[model samples]
Target: MKKKLLTVAIGSAVALTIAGCNSSSNSTDTDTNKLLPKDATIAFAGVKAPVTDAEKRAILASDATITTGSDSMPLDLEYNVFARSGDTFDHAVFGQLVDKQGNPLSKEDGSPSIANSNEFTSLLPRGERLFSVSQFESRPGAMFLMELNQNTENGELSVKDAWQIDQSGVNGGWVHCAGSVTPWSTHLASEEYEPNARSLVTGADAAADRYAAGFLDYFNGDESQWNPYQVGWNIEVDVQADSGAAPTATSKKHYAMGRLAFELSYVMPDEKTVYMTDDGTNVGLYMFVADKAGDLSAGTLYAMKWNQTASTGVGAADLDWIDLGHATSAELSDYIEGANQLAFTDIFATADANEDNSCPDGFTSINAGGNGQECLQVKPGMEKAASRMETRRYAAMMGATTELRKEEGITFDPTRSKLYLAMSEVARGFESFKKNGADSSSYDLGGPNHIQLEGFNRCGAVYQLDVASDATIGSSYVAKNMSALVAGVPATDSYGDGVQNPIVANSADYADNNKCHIDGISNPDNVTYMSGWDILIIGEDTGSGHQNDVIWAYDFGTQALTRIQTTPYGSETTSPYWYPNINGWGYLTSVVQHPYGESDSDKDTGNGENRAYTGYVGPFPAKAE
Candidate 1:
């Protein structure tokens, strides 16, 4: 159930030049149609932040649908799935009924699909199994989220069976890449975030896009036996998981998030943790804390070095890193518990998506799209998921470094304290990732498919961090004008292969816009990716995505995630859908946020005025008591 590619290209209007090491003077102007930190202030710090004058006329006069309740928030679900090859393995749990514009009213004729389950076979004790849709049909304030799942359960996550959580379990089958969602409640589901290029050099072709439709190779080995490059991303599933969970064979590998090519990890309401460097080449932004996890007990993992950049730019010299002189951060977190080192080879010396190890070979276009390229084939020890040998000697050894390279969407900020980095591309700052001409090895990417969109140069950025001290986002002007990073593709899907940037066409969502930072704030309270505003969004059914792969919502304000509402979703020739990929979702790989509530902008006030509900986006209908 993999396939989710998110890039940040940036090349429109062409004719530019810069990356040749700016040296700073704040941004030594060479001018190639402009845009380098060029005073746009790096993009945007608060976008405007000045609001005050009576909260700017009450967001210019209210009615975005301000809500705390249109009603329906009660859920009791337990859909699960696992079992890949044969035996009873059918995996299908479905439901769809949307409204409020993202559409899909099922067929309006009373929109339906209500609740579903495809009878699971047996993954055992905690491998996966649980289902109880909250009466099904949705719409109240609308947001019956999550839109992909192969084995359903944890992947479809929607349960309230009063609440179970057997210590957190995992055995394993195909929940292979990416997971983490537990501020307090629990949604760690499984583990899987497949992709391994290590040094492919950018020919970029993850299979024509449409979200790559669930790659299916059926694992036997070759391209490097798929990949397990060490640095594992955790997989110990099974706890009664509110998720009717799935995917387990014998899962048991959590050496504290480290092992290149690993994906999915985020927890903070003080749970203390942060991960997602995904290095096949891409580093920087890797952290771990756990003060006291329901498990881990303790914590230590850090890597996020960035400084030395004044080649003429003028500002940027508070930099820090070069301290191998003694190695501290608690002796590299006990030196990985003893160094059997399953993954995260150089901890962070990781090659280059710009994390920095001077990537000559390792870059970062990554994969998991195109239905996982006919069943996955970008191998290298299963693309390094803790370098398997039964979990790479049980990695726990602490320290390692390539000096933080080309990092990607790792999370943490909803109060677990702070850490929200996202950079399959970052290095010029503002004028949207500085690229008039580039030359450290070249990196200028522009807009379309692969990068997910909404506005500007195909925009590719979501960098915000405060993880208390690891900090980040101070560059200013709201991160250099920031209105960029939008190419979740779909400039228009019309149907199937419409193909914009199409690296899998786009649908892994930075925030189906229910405004999920779940407290993982990648940039100011989960900078909710905006483009049609998001009431609930998740797309995939084909490359460049569009065959009814659904989940949508829109229109919100104050902080603005905009999706207004939805319920009783419908769909006919097209445009009115209510998802039900089987039991609950279909072939998914990642979606984390358990224990929930870690906010930044609910924007409520009364004493002096500013009661804006953070920018309510309205339209909540569909009900079924």
Candidate 2:
């Protein structure tokens, strides 16, 4: 049998093209037909990890049995599956394969543990192979064989099986996290980031920006094209289930989808609007206004920012209609020289806390054509930091030379009008050294400081966001009005049914974190808990790289955060976090919800579309008796 390749949490991404378009104008199409919401936003970043029972309930409760196309379909089985490429996240290979006993398979040494009795056929769905001990056998219940929606001619990894469902395209890559069948009979697949970029980008525009220097590097400059240039986008996959090919790439680029890693997507019962999330951690949060609402083609983009309580400020607003509206390649290079200087300057400051070199030599604003750090950018060398410079030096440590967000996992509740966000576990402390301890001396980042002030929020947590069902809050969540509902406090148990906090060195106070679970809330209006408008899902990784596969829930109305009933991290290759951590591959890629039985998500049935279905990013927690 062939080895199984684990997928990244935030694997692929795509770009939207909805510029000046009003999907409402689709009067030409049948009145029953409507485009998806282009103006969406994700308000989940820098939020604390969940710790209470309520937070855990949100994730488990999301699986309620309501409506279903087939009574025989299993809708409430608490399912989790692995994600593959969607043309956006181009990891080595993606997806999860486990055994019937729920035991995880291994992907060690660049190879998976496949017993001689297992099957190993390349073309999925068609060529059959009986397996005795393969990733497939590790699954709990009956397994569904899904494949990348690309043509066989495209690459070696093509779906050769006689499978059924809907979705396909040359790059008909499926957005792992978010998926929804449109009211118009199409499915919406989310593209997290630009796969072509390959490595994560620490600085947004590499063309000019470097560390945090103010001067340009005359020597060894420009030749490497060290310029931060990446062709990427957030795309929607149209599920033409009728044909084997679904989620067509022809979907328009939602201009409303500001700029960031497109994490998840959701639709409302009204069937005229959609919602999305920017899975970029500590980056931004926002919402968009679809020109015609749901027109996916064109719409106005906006972001949500929080003002101090009673400060009387505008929390949500779209960025200026600048030439390079979204994160465009053109604007990234204008001040190329200035950018490089700024980057190196910051790097130097991190090595040694010398304010003299803190402010680079030539990093003047006027030189970069009005392009500089977006105020929200994190600067090194702070007096009140919790750890050493290595804490904030993500670029140098992780190949993230440009992008700095490891954000992942996002879901939406149309009925409750909420979003559920989760992030990977924190691998290390705020310090560069892989040690975990709370010195409170190196806690200086904008978002990091805010989290420390709040008691509970520690490592590898989840958050909730209050948002409108029709608002565009996904792709542009960076500037969103973010508020931490749940604090990521550690647990009393360490080796229990919970995830581990990667930064254990700084977390001496939180040693017994076994029972510790980063959770979120849902249906906050309940008398016992708080109410959440939408749930945003995201996670943080410990410096160790051991991914903790857990989900958090939240409620917008009561302003409460709940924890989900997650079992624990699987220590095998078949486990959820294996690929992203062990293999040093995959990401918390994307979080999405599709209809039961079929991989299509429909919201018209109402926010109360109480239908049961199984969704997975890993193995299903519903262990069979």
Per-residue lDDT over 328-409 for candidate 2, one digit per residue giving the tens place of the 0 to 100 score: 2232222222343223233333222225323233221110001112111234542111011111122112111111123344
Report lDDT (CA) for all predictions: 0.24, 0.26
Off by over 4 Å in 1: 1-129, 132-231, 234-251, 254-258, 261-625
Kindly report which residue stretches of model 2 are placed more than 4 angstroms away from their true locations once superposed: 1-185, 191-231, 241-259, 265-276, 308-456, 459-462, 468-487, 492-625
| Number of clashes found in candidate 1 | 223
- Using lDDT, give the best candidate's number: 2
Q: Candidate 1, after superposition: displacement of residue 77 in Å?
A: 17
lDDT digits (tens) for residues 506-621 of candidate 1 = 33331232111111111111122221212222211111112111222212233323211111111101011121122222211111111011221133232312110100111111
TM-score for each predicted model, relative to the true structure: 0.25, 0.40
lDDT of 2 at 363: 26
